[model samples]
Target: DCKKAVSGKSFYAMEGKPVCPKCVGVDEEEEEEEEA
Candidate 1:
C-alpha cells in the first residue's frame, strides 16, 4: 500500500509524486516501538 517504505527513509516516489508515511497517518516513532 502507500505505507510501503523505501530503505529506512520515510519518503518515496510513486507515479512521479512524492509519498510519505506521515501523509497516511503513519507515525515513525510508533513503527520503531513496534519493531522493538
Candidate 2:
C-alpha cells in the first residue's frame, strides 16, 4: 500500500512506498520507449 504525505502546499502526494530495483528498471525502459 502507498502512504500519503501532507505538504505545506496543500497537496497530498503518495509516499513511503518501497520499490524494487527490477521494477525501476522496467519503468525506465518504458519511459525510453515512449521518448523514442
Candidate 3:
C-alpha cells in the first residue's frame, strides 16, 4: 500500500479526504492532460 502511494498507483484518504501526496501529483497530471 505504501509502495502504491509512493508510485502514484493508488490514493490514500482519511475521513473521505485524500492524503496521499503521490496520488495528488498523479491527479494533477491527469487534469492537465484533460485540459490540453
Best by TM-score: 1
lDDT of 2: 0.36
Whole-model Cα lDDT per candidate? 0.58, 0.36, 0.48
Per-candidate alpha-carbon RMSD to the true structure: 7.8, 9.7, 6.6
Model 1: weakest 10-residue lDDT segment is 27-36
Work out the TM-score per prediction. Answer: 0.29, 0.24, 0.24
Candidate order (TM-score)? 1, 3, 2
lDDT of 1 by residue, 1-36 (tens): 454545675674556666675665555556454542
Off by over 4 Å in 3: 1-7, 21-36
> lDDT of candidate 1?
0.58
TM-score of 3: 0.24
Residue 11 Cα positional deviation in candidate 3, in Å, after optimal superposition: 1.1
Q: Give me the displacement of residue 19 in model 1, in angstroms.
A: 1.4
Which tens-of-lDDT digit does each residue in 1-36 have in candidate 3? Answer: 223434544455745775565544445345445443
Q: What lDDT score is found at residue 7 in candidate 2?
A: 38
**Candidate topping lDDT:** 1
